[model samples]
Target: MPLMRPRMATARLTPSRRPHPVTAAGAKPAAASTMGGTLRALSLLAVLAAAILATGCSTAQIEQLKHSRTGIASGERVVILARQHHSTHEAELDFVECVGNALSRGANGLEIASHSDFVNGLYPWFEPAIAPLNPEELPALLARPGVAERLAETGVRYVVWMDGMTERVDGGGSLSCAAGPGGAGCFGLAWWETDARYEAAVWDLKHVDQAGLISADVTGRSVIPAVIVPLPFISRPQANACRGLAQQLQEFLVVEDQLTR
Candidate 1:
C-alpha cells in the first residue's frame, strides 16, 4: 500500500450566532425602571417651573379722585413729603423718593423740589410737629408770618403729601432644618404675602384748594425653597405701588380734558 500522507489537525467553526435582544424577559424589568425614572425627572422639572412663575410677582389696584382741575407751569415746583400725622405707619423715605424722581422724569414731567431741601427751606413751619396733615390745613399754615412770601420766592406751586406703609399681611408655609455628624443642612419651603398701601393728596398752594387724591394698594407673593441654603424670592410691593401711583399722579396733574370725578 502506498505510504499515507500525515493528516493535519484543523479546528472547525459553526455559523456566526445572531445578536439576541438586550431587553429580553430577564432585562425587561430594568428597562421599565429606566423609563420610569425619566418620567419622574420630567415631572419634577415642570413643578419647579410652575413654582417660579407663581413667585416674585406683584399686582396693584390704583384709584384717583379729582377735587379740582390742576396743572403745573414750567416755573412752578412740586414737592413730595411723607405725612407723619397718620395714625397708621407713614410712607417709607425710599417710596417717597421713588415717586418724586418718577414725577420729575420725562419731557412732560413737572419740576420737583428736593424733599429735604424743601422741608428745610420751610423749616419750623413744616416741622413734623406742625406740618399740615391735609389740604384744608394748608391755608392756616400758609397764613403764618413769612410763610407766604417764602413759598412764593421759592416758586413752590404744589404740595403732595403721602402716607402709608407696607406690611406682611399673610403667609402660609413650613420649613425645618437639621444637623448630623455626617453633615449639617437645611431643607424645606416657605412663603409669604406682602401688602403695600399708599395714598397721596395733592394740594395747590396758589389756589388754596385740593387738586387730586391718588392711592395704590399692591399685593405680592414671595417664596423660598431651600435644600442646603435658603433661596429667597422677594416681591417688591412698595416699589410697585410707588411706580403705579406716580404714573397716575403725573396724569392727574396734567389737567387733560376734564378730570376723573
Candidate 2:
C-alpha cells in the first residue's frame, strides 16, 4: 500500500509588501515570527498523522474449510509461517507478524511458539531453498536425520502456511501541494483502492495431515482530500484481513468440548 507521500519545505510569512526599509528591531520580530510559523506547521503535521491513523474504513470476509479433524490439546502451541520462497505471491513479514500477535491475544487465545527461535532450531531445513511448501512434503522432510526430533521439541500442533499479499488494485484522483515564502497549503483530492487476499493452509503436524484452510479477503479505499491540511481517510485492508483470519484460525483449532487453561 502507498503511504502518505508529501514533500514540504519550511516556509514563512514576511511583512506584507512593506514600503519602509527593514530595521534591526523589525528584523528580530520577523525571525521570531518565522520560528512560530514553523512550529505551527509541525503541529499541523502531527495532527494529520493522527487523523490518518484514526480514520479508516475496511471490509473483510473469512471462510474456513476443514479437510480433516483439527484441534490443539493442552500445552500444545502453533507456529505461523509464510511463503517467503515464492516469487510474486509471498506473504509480507508485517502481515505474518500481525496474525501471530492476534492469535496470541485475548483470554482464550492459543499458545504461539517463538517464530524466530523455531525457525532457527530447524535452520537449513526451513530455509527458503529447502523449506517444504506443503504438507505432502513433510514426510520426506521428517525422514531427514534430526528434523523430526527437532520439530518434536517445539510441541507445535499445527503449522499454518500463509500465502498471498495486499495489492493496489485500482485508484483515481489527484492532489497537489506547494510551498513558498508566503507559507504552504495543499489542495485537490486523491484516492486509491487496495485489496488484501490471503489464504492459509493448516497442516496438522501431530497427525501428519491437513487440518483445514482459512481464507480472508478484504477490500478498502483510501482517500486524501486536501483543502488546507490533507485529511486522509485511509483504508487498511491488510489489517482487517489479519484480524479476521486470526479470529477464525483460533476458532478452527479450539474445540468447545475441550477447553484448557
Candidate 3:
C-alpha cells in the first residue's frame, strides 16, 4: 500500500449526541435504579446499531463475507465500543454491527450486549505508531486515550474496535495477438481493469475499557479478504465495505455457534 501523509484528525459525532439519562426524577430509588440501568443498556445498543448504517452503503462481495461466519454460544453477551474520529456515525455503526456478528459466530456462548451511542473521540497515538495511513485510516485511536477508560466505567467487559479506508491504484491492461493474413493480419485485443478496494478491520480487546495496557487483536477481516473487481467509483466503497463487514460478522457469529437464534 502506498503511504499517504496523515491528515489532521477531526470530530464527526453522531447527530444523536446526548447520553440517555440514567435516572428519572420523581421516582422511587429502587425503580429508578433499575430503569436507569435498563435505559442505559438500551441506549447503548441503539447507538451501536445506528452506527452500523451511518456510512450508508453495500456490495456482493460484502454479502459473501457476511454469510461466511457462524454463531456464538447460546447466550454469552459481548460489548461493543465503537468510537469514531474523522469518520461518520454511519461508518461507526457499521463496524459495531460487524463485530457483533463475528462474535456471535466465533464464540458459541457469546451474545451482543447493546452497543453505546457513537461518540466523538480522538486517535492521538496512531500518528507515528502506525505509518503511512492517515489518522482516519485507523479507528483504534478512539480507544487509546481516555475512551477505553470511559467504556470500562460503563461496565463493558470486552470491546470491539473498528476502522476502514478505501483507495484506488493504477488499473491498466496489456494484450498480445498473432499475425494472420493480409495487412489486417493481427487480431485486436483489449483488456479492462480497475484497481479499487475497501478494507475494514475489527479489533477485539479482552478487557480494554478497564485496562490501560490492554492488548488489542485485529480479530479478523470483516469483509471478503478478496477485493472487489471493477471498483464502484461512483459509490462509497469503504462505506459499503463496512456495511458488509457488519452484516457478514452478524452472519458468521450466528453460523459459527457463537450467537444462537
Model 3: per-residue Cα lDDT at residue 34: 39
TM-score of each: 0.76, 0.73, 0.28
lDDT score for residue 63 of model 2: 72
Question: Model 2 shows how many backbone clashes?
Answer: 0
Candidate 2, residues 148-258: lDDT per residue as tens digits?
899989988798889999999988878899899888767666878899999988898887877778888887767665545556666678987888898888887885332
Give residue 223's error in model 1 in angstroms: 1.1
- Angstrom error of the Cα, residue 125, model 2: value is 2.1
Query: Which candidate has the highest lDDT of all?
Result: 2
| Residue lDDT tens for model 1, 104-207 | 88766988888888888889878778887667888888889988998897788888989899999988877788788866545567888999898888888988
Report the Cα lDDT for residue 30, model 2: 41
Backbone clashes, each candidate: 0, 0, 50
- Which pairs clash inside model 1? none
By lDDT, is 1 or 3 better? 1
Off by over 4 Å in 1: 1-43, 177-186, 227-231
Query: What value of lDDT does candidate 3 attain over all alpha carbons?
Result: 0.34
Better of 1 and 2 by TM-score: 1
lDDT of 3 by residue, 169-241 (tens): 2223323334434321111222222222333332233322221111111111111100111111122334434
What lDDT does candidate 3 reach at residue 142?
43
